[model samples]
Target: MYEFCPHCGLKYEVEPGYFYGAMFVSYAISGGVALVLGFILFYLAGDPGGWVYVAVIAPAMVLIAPVNFRFSRVLWLHYVAGIKYQPEL
Candidate 1:
């Protein structure tokens, strides 16, 4: 990731290791996706076999990992680090 926001020139990391907390945010995002997908598999798909669940969920998770990783870090910056949005910037 860039050390600063290209548009506004704001520093990306407040301090060293700041993004370590984003790991928890990423975990939460993964858990939420798993829970929702599990429900869909259980109810809509009529309780597919364990292997089916693994096959479908694993790929979906992998597909969303990039988005989830970026979002999680942004979330950590906005909420945990109290970085406020400044549209004027």
Candidate 2:
């Protein structure tokens, strides 16, 4: 599975453990985006109850779960694949 690069089409083998980093990256991106959105809502609403923040942001985060999964896989492929393509003359 870790045998292809998505960006450049380069083929090289990589250890399975290498993908763990991509998972971290994906979680960080998703969580950070959700947190920021939560903060924005809090500010706009004059810092309402804590539940307000959770209620609004939790759904947004759930909505993004699928997208995050897909993004993580693509990122992993890019890192592992290390494959590059060249244009034909």
Every model's TM-score: 0.93, 0.66
Best by lDDT: 1
lDDT of each: 0.93, 0.73
In model 2, which range of ten residues has the least summed lDDT? Answer: 80-89
Q: CA lDDT of 57 in candidate 2? A: 83
Candidate 2 lDDT, 15-87, residue by residue in tens: 6475677788788888898879877987788888889888888888899888887787677667656534456
For model 1, residues 10-85, the per-residue Cα lDDT tens digits are 8989899999999999999998998899999999999999999999889999999999999999999999888898
Give the residue spans of candidate 1 off by over 4 A: none
